[model samples]
Target: MTMREIAFSLVAVAGLLATATAKAQAPEPFGRPGASDAKGAIELIDPKVLRVCADPNNLPFSNRAGEGFENKLAQFLAGKLGKDLAYVYYPGATGFIRNTLNAHLCDVVMGMPQGDDVVQPTNPYYRTSYAIVTRAGADLDGLKTLADPRLAQKGRHIGLVANTPPGNVLARLGLLAAVKPYPLVVDTRVDAPGADMIHDLEAGAIDVAILWGPIAGYHVKRSNGRLVETLLTQEPGARMSFRIGMGVRHSDQEWKRELNRLIAQNQREIDRMLADYGVPLIDEAGAPIAVEP
Candidate 1:
């Protein structure tokens, strides 16, 4: 599939915190009925329905047709809670939380980076990092980190999403000059940065591409064994990794705890779903989350 079709898919599962930029740093909590108060009295969300705020078109996460991994997981969780599943559809971009969660249209966002100030996070369900994509047996195959000297010494071309943490890491490693910047704000009509990067790597247009792990993993799964993905978690101070969790309104402490309980109760199932969708999950220590046999 074209990257345009799956552009938001990888980052959504990778927990890139891209949505964190679309809204204010500190999201306002839910308010009671008939009021515009920031600290309005709590309105209890109904437990009979697991209302989710999600993108209608984003793949590998959630879609209007409920085909994505997050969609499936939401269904499972809702079933476990003895609740029906519902969605508040919106584009997964700026103003997402403002229009959906904050507007009380939905009670949960299934994939938010932990520690995100925009939403109160549940206990992290998965961890992942940026990854380097290269030819499976190429000279760069053994490449583990952006600090590898051969990258600059051999004048290899690198592709990365602009203004992302990986881009900052490359710049700090003095490899910015050889890097090709892909627009973070892409026009789906004409640009597919992540997919394009993979295509270029296959065609030898770029020697390597640094991408979010979920994105890399998804594309690599379709690469016919031609691509190699190396997670960049070994680099000290790279800050290229993050843990992802469910998002709830700040005042929904009870709701958050309930979600956390669900997470703990079904972590193995959750991990299996992530693995099925090719999310490159890692642990707090940066080790891969192994899949079941």
Candidate 2:
């Protein structure tokens, strides 16, 4: 959950990260492929199998059990493409893209920020934002951002991932002292901080949790009326929203286009799937889309 919420921390931690840097303003070193390249490199991908690189334990995204939304999406795509599905399981820590896609162990990444430099992204399928999760009907249910004056009130504690954009806004609001910070990176195989945060909130350890939208959405849906999640739209200094797309190696232009076609043809089904999983999807104008409570 560091900054962009995926791969940014991995890029830094891997040290060998040549791309995936936070320079979104810069053009992608590998631009989108033209229709001609689609025919040129179509052979690089297997015609009979759909391969995916994924974290073995990252919930709401992927897991070894094929229970996460991304896992479901991969299965759906594979069915549509008339191919058997395969997975390259990695820790999603450092070298996620390297050990999986670059090593030729997999063909696609199910979900990541649209403009990642290391991978050529297909058309974005969904958008989400950072959100605040709280116990239902609590006084803090009205929370919109960390900068809200109610957060500065006595005994009000906010839980957030350290080094994320929301953390920066809290610091500027002089609310850092009252924040319960979670680690930005950890062994996902053993830790689930977002779930832990929800547990703590229910147990009254913190008043609220500011989490990535997918994480918040999934957990809130499971909370069964005990908790409520809402997107944060009031923060000015931090970038709170992002669009997610499938990622492929930079050389796999034709594969990228194929994925894009799948995305275009299945967008309605994709939106419904994401909503069922409690993903807080939004449109380009910052308006919500296919989002469920």
Candidate 3:
């Protein structure tokens, strides 16, 4: 079957997992879902500081050392607002939002998906898609999509984060039976699946690896041109791309609006930051963000 088949069956598998994970990971309702009462439900915190909640060891995204792109982005936002940047460290897994944002440990989450129910999202500053990583100038040089028949060829092995969209796609294509599935629930202190997948690809343990665009892009850059990445822009009637935005508590409408304004006003700067970190952004039309030669 082709990726079209993967596309069709993917919804079922994904929906099942999303539902299960959400239910299992769901924290207490965040003071209502969408709109929040600023005076009652929301706690008034110091608006002069950019208190960002983030995972301390999730790289290409965040870390305690202020080396990740999200940390840099936070610093930029804080600078724009003329506020000091502060962090509330938490593992980005189940109850992350509940324990951090909801509990008022911090004011914002710098890199969450748009439309996330746990918190209100600002207008997305950038959008990204899944990426395919392979050795540069290799036989898979021109491979663009998971639908490529070459992926099913003899002796081919694929690496993917288990229970993700790409993993669901591979499973539907009957490729998962041969693919090496990396655990999604990793120990934040030790493993970084995205970096690990790229490392495995470089070491010849896997033929190709499918990963989120930003993660793949960042590692490929750090790989010193040893690896190449192409954004997967086609899904044949499935969602493969997502818009990323910062999240605030649902009751923080004023805070969300202020952030939306900041995002719009500073989008160019934000895009530059993302590009510098090797995030593969795409236009709303699903075209790749052009890179200057």
Over 4 Å off, model 2: 1-6, 9-45, 291-293
Cα lDDT tens digits, model 3, 220-248, are 88888889998887765346787778877
For candidate 1, the C-alpha RMSD (Å) to the true structure equals 5.5
Q: Pick the candidate with the highest TM-score.
A: 2
Off by over 4 Å in 1: 1-21, 34-46, 186-192
Return the TM-score for each candidate structure: 0.85, 0.86, 0.85
Give all candidates' CA lDDT scores.
0.72, 0.72, 0.70
Show pairs that collide, candidate 2. none
TM-score winner, 1 or 2: 2
Give the alpha carbon lDDT tens digit for every residue of 1-293 in model 2: 44344445322211001122232332223432222333434534456778888777777777899988889999999999888999988766655676667666777878767657667788889877778998998898777767778889999988877666677788778889999977666666786677778889999999998887888888899888999988975587777776778877777766777889989998989999989978878888878874433
lDDT, candidate 2, at 82: 80
- Candidate 3 residue pairs in backbone clash: 36-251
**Model 3: runs farther than 4 Å from truth?**
1-44, 291-293
Whole-model lDDT for model 1 versus the true structure?
0.72
